[model samples]
Target: MVSLTRISEYVAQTANIIGGVLELDVLIVDRSLRIIGDSDLASVSEEECIRKDSILAKVMAEKEQIILSSKEHNAGCASCLQRNLCMVEMIIGIPIFFESKILGSIGIIANTLYDKEKMINNQENYLKFIDRMIELLTNRLKEEQALEEISLLKKRMEVVLDSIDDFLVLVSRDGEILQTNLNFKNIFKRKKPKYLNEVLCADVVDQLLNDSEEVKFKEVKVNKIHDFLLSSKPVIVDQKDHGALLSFKSIKDVAVEMNELYTHSMDVVFDDLVGESPQINMVKERIKQIASSSSTVLIDGETGTGKEVIARLIHNTSTRSNAPFVAINCSAIPEDLMESELFGYEEGAFSGAKKGGKIGKFQLASGGTIFLDEIGEMALHLQSKLLRVLQERQVNKIGGLESTEVDVRILAATNKRLEDLVKQGRFREDLYYRLKVIPITSPPLRERKDDIRLLVDYFISYYASRIGKDINGISDNAMGILMEHPWKGNVRELRNVIEFSINMSTGDMITQTSLPFDLVHPTQEYDEDLNIEVVTQRLIEKALIKYGDSTIAKEMAAKSLGISVATLYRKMKELDLKNSIG
Candidate 1:
């Protein structure tokens, strides 16, 4: 039986399409006697039911077709309570039926009284057209109901099999998959297959189907790293083999169960992140919210700002922390070899390919996190391929026929501005949206100057212990100089400065004298009133003091100052510093 709701939905869908076909307005009344669909954008509400004396109500009660023309109706119009109020010039309402039971009706209305008179004069042709349309709607409703039933049955079986312990798949005698569970789909990385060989190897299918004797359980390697115990048994129906039931249990899962006694520890924690700034704190909170979900993350920050460190921290705090963490630098790799390096290559993919083929960073990072640094450097052509892999959750190796499905989490970082790249048409806009699902920007050092003192003290102690120096702390003058520097290279540059000062220190405390010459004798703006020679002399003196007596250093200093080493040496000699250097 066709449901009233289903019949109403079919009417609404057909409303607009049928207007051009019949060149007349159409209205649908479902079994509930409610006006369901109207093509003319009519004033009547779809929720309203037909009144008892309306022409439509009488036709539905009588289970017959009624034609209303400009002229009076034969008998129905006499009894219709709405005859006075109904402005409809002409209408044809016919009862739709299924298995001899009245279901609903379709009504086609004429545009004007003249049109109504003309339609009534050629009533037979209009009836035939209306009858044909009703027949099509009835058949379509039956087909939709049948499909709905099949879908419900499939969902019920999936739920039942998914609750079972083992990974299960049912196949027909001809090696067609009859049913499979989510675990089976996830483990094999395949969907419902028409042929068993689509999900399993051809050899495995042939062996299982052809063997008449009891099939013994066997160990088989499914992917590169996982091994599973596979077994098949005949599904009997009335003493005849109908199909086979296949099941598997992974060896690694069993090992993990037994090793549950061992303690597992994460590689990173909130404490490992040094800064107490609000910006860093807010970032940590965001990581906590999104880390568990399997969404792609984009880390945006300048170079040497520890983007990879954020990636690692997110992975360590995630559920997949037990798995490996693999990283690839997109800008570091050569353009020609990038595809093969990222997606892997089959053996002999190219002349110098590795023997037995190599797994890509994506495949290696399965069940873990893969960090793609400098993702903005990926080429446009490769960006399209990467988008496909992310969409399908599968990778096709270079020179390889089969595609492998991966369960890896993606964490990408870039020093470049990707949105600007998108506007420049150098990056794929779709791929940009895909990677920035959870965008995080590491704070630059200049913006978070409050953390500088803590970072400086930490690095001083860190490098001091590493270099076996007795340096206990930084002097007030050295600390003052550090706070004033621009720190163009961020934290990484700060660490380098501390390391250099520690090596040059001659006392327990790091002082101004032990600092690099560039820091100790930093450049200062000269007075505008000074003469050209005075300004020139002052610039020469700073360079000579910074580079000292080293020829290579002086040469580099002179070149940076846009002068020749000979000129710098002459100036130093004129200043009476030549003998002081010797």
Candidate 2:
């Protein structure tokens, strides 16, 4: 049984390729005698399908490979002149095939050179390959159509079984278990079987079905059966009742049932993000401004600083929130497959490519956000092609003749310093400018001590629910230790530490003892803290001497030093530098 869809599609494509090679139209049809695939540039009509003079119909009826020529067929058949006027006017000859037994016929119409034996051999090989495919498709269709009918029958049987207090089972005439709903497994402590091999109805009545007195069908297995009052009825579909279907549930039973249930939740939201300090606030504000615009965003940050999360937030908050937010880890994707993963490839494009071809991430994320995480790891050669896509807004698949127009918003993230990369001539400077139209940096956890309390409390609650425990908040000492520690891995590391402590701690409050060994243990502090007043005075004096005193503002000096202006002003006051202020 060759799959009609695939066979028809291939036949159509081959017809076109052969048609192009020889100059003609191509058509493919299925067994229901309907045209399923057509490669003709000219339009076709539905009624043209049943025309007796058509090459496809002749191929199906004759059960042989064919090459139909307009010159010969129209002159021979009476009904063919009209068909010639309607179809195959330009077709000098086309290959039509009857590939398999019981599988639908495929007719490829082409005005091409006739190499009949070779073309027929190709069709036979294709048919053999698609035999299993057609069977699977046909079986799936049968199951789908039967689903609704079977579901209704099961519901009707539920009431009859509810009246009984014990397990019930119904086996077939051949002693094969045909139907078992969720109830029998629960009541009798029987695992719902993957398949029923030799279970019969009579065996079930004697062994599993409770209340022999309640049984209404006298024979248990009858030639022609109908409904019996307050008892199971024969399940029917399209006037034919399938094997016995019985339903029974128990009020109390333990089957030791367990399943690995999984839930996929998008737990990361913009509000879950920590950081209110000014250094981070400026970046957040800039992200907010740029998120609304359709410009390409390049997020630069150190590893584990939540670049991907920030990228997600921008996508979730933007105008395209309803559309897909597809993320591709550029570094993780293999270099050899990266091209196909981005631009997709056509059927028979390369060895091992799927027959019908694949749709790429770009096509999948059309009109949505595509997050290219770890983009600095993208290959240099691919970077040039990527730049072309950003500029062109379209992509051509591998071996595909046409380009598909895409309107995808790019939001690329990287932990690598791209500016340094561009300066070193590793990354294209043009692409850098294209992506850096808006850049957002997530402040590392150590940079914002004030927000540590909020983050700790959040993680405490989060981890508690996750591990199925309810613990009290962190103590002041634990909080102090947390704030004192430098978070190299940022918030991600902090969350892990909290989770570990919560798992280890039995008491309500997270004490210093419960904290990880690294944090709980003390280390020597940096002894030589620089003189703030002297350092700021010298810095501001130097800047003012060159740029002029009035031009060099307190805010400018503080920013240049990568320190707080408040700290700088405090230093200015201590050094008597305010006396020189306007």
Candidate 3:
């Protein structure tokens, strides 16, 4: 007989293998007469096995071997209800027995009269062999089923561990690393280390393990950067310690939430910028080339393109790295107060001046760099003063008699086209030329789609650590969606999307369902944004209010908006603003 191997489904595989070796075709059925396994020839006569009055069913109900010899087939052929369709002249059905109970039945069909006499002569021997085969197959199937269940359980446990935000490590009693979650691997950026000390915070791990008392949730600084609470529990097997389960929480989050720290200053090394794209390499090379220069640099890109990050990199690599790098948003400050904020006011200089003269951003950044973000938004009068400061490398604080001699390098950034602003007489032409001495434009995220995968991994690791979730990675489908997105908000939008996904995800891997509603249904979000038509109408109303309500004023407003008078008139009519304008 042919050998039997384990099958995935709950069925006997031995019957078909045995049939292949013997001339007799075989069919195996369960208690309900469900055909579980059949030989090649038996497959053609499948209808014969499952019938209520079938030989296999009769054998199963009788719990004994039933043989239809040639004499029995010929003598009772007319009376048998299935005689017309029955092809076998002689057939034997043996009940499959396990632990004194009937499991099912296995049928063997003889092809010739000579074979039928051979089957009848060896009926007792066949019964004993069939009983042994059934017993062996039953035991084998039970073992395989148990193993399959255990495998599934282990998989489920791993998935649960991966979803946790904290660093989780399973270490043997001998201090060997057994397993670890993505959060732990992300910080070290390596595969699981053989030894615990090689990857974990050595000091924290040592303290937690060596401590005699329970040391759960003990706060410690890992690698002098991450503040984490270490928790360790002994995995007792048979009342003996088998291993340890180590988990950690980020105490840095608690510090921020409790208002113990207002801001965190992470060292922005060039290596921290994660991208291998040629565009990013070029930007890195440019930063290196101009790091030591004192010339004013103009950084330009859409919002969230990391303009401020590049500016900081320049300051960190410069000769004045030890000095302060002051940054100010030119547009964020009120127009009336921007001048005083940039150049400190003397005591009694304004209605509410400080008791002593305050050091302005220029004086504060002396011997260093002052980053002027949104510099294009500076008022015309302030631009002229700023131009003089850049030229002379000194600052004359507001309401101060003597000019304060300062040595500061100015680095300005803007999303607007300063050249267009200059042509429109909104920005000073001279100032634009001065700031663009060493211009660098940061590439938008969409332009660097090749880097999206790298960036996504970085963001997943970063936000997962921050929020204390155990997100290990993203699904392939989710990453594809991210790469395809236009990323209008650039890197900032990508970061937000990742953060949103990490929070919403219920599993270790960020799946499609974890994506934000707006991202999942982008058209709906687009339509929602399009519903802001009132913003455009409000802009037209403000322009008319500032100029005048007359046709002449409307012409001037249209010129400022870079649109023709007729277009403006048509838009006003379309927006139902014909009566509102004077």
State which candidate has the highest lDDT: 1
Give lDDT tens digits, candidate 2, residues 238-305: 76544444433211111101001111144356676766778667766776787677788888776777
In TM-score terms, candidate 2 sits at 0.46
lDDT of 2 at 131: 41
lDDT of each: 0.76, 0.61, 0.76
Model 1, 1-582: lDDT tens digits are 575557566667666556667677887777777877778755557578765556666677789987766437545556667668766788788887877888777777886877687677777887787787777777887887889899999888789889877788788889888877788777656434567776556666787787633454454445444556577788888988777998876644543332233223325677656687887877788889987888999999877777877888898889887776777889999988889888888766889986546567676677777889999999998898889888999988889888878888899999876765785688899999999999998887877888888888888888999999998898999889888887768888888889999999999998998889987676756745478767777776666554544667689769867898888877777777655531
Clashing pairs in 2: 1-131, 3-134, 171-200, 171-201, 175-198, 175-199, 175-200, 176-198, 176-199, 177-199
State in Å the error of residue 19, model 1. Answer: 99
Candidates in order, TM-scores: namely 0.47, 0.46, 0.47
Regions of candidate 3 where Cα sits further than 4 Å from its true position? 1-266, 524-582
Residues forming the 10-long window of minimal summed lDDT in candidate 2: 251-260
Put down candidate 3 lDDT per residue, 58-124, tens digits, no spaces.
Answer: 7878889777775354444556787667667677788876556777888888877776777788878
What stretches of model 1 exceed 4 Å from their correct place? Answer: 1-266, 523-582
- lDDT (Cα) of model 2: 0.61
Name the candidate, 1 or 2, with the larger lDDT value.
1
Clashing pairs in 3: 164-470, 165-469, 165-470, 549-582
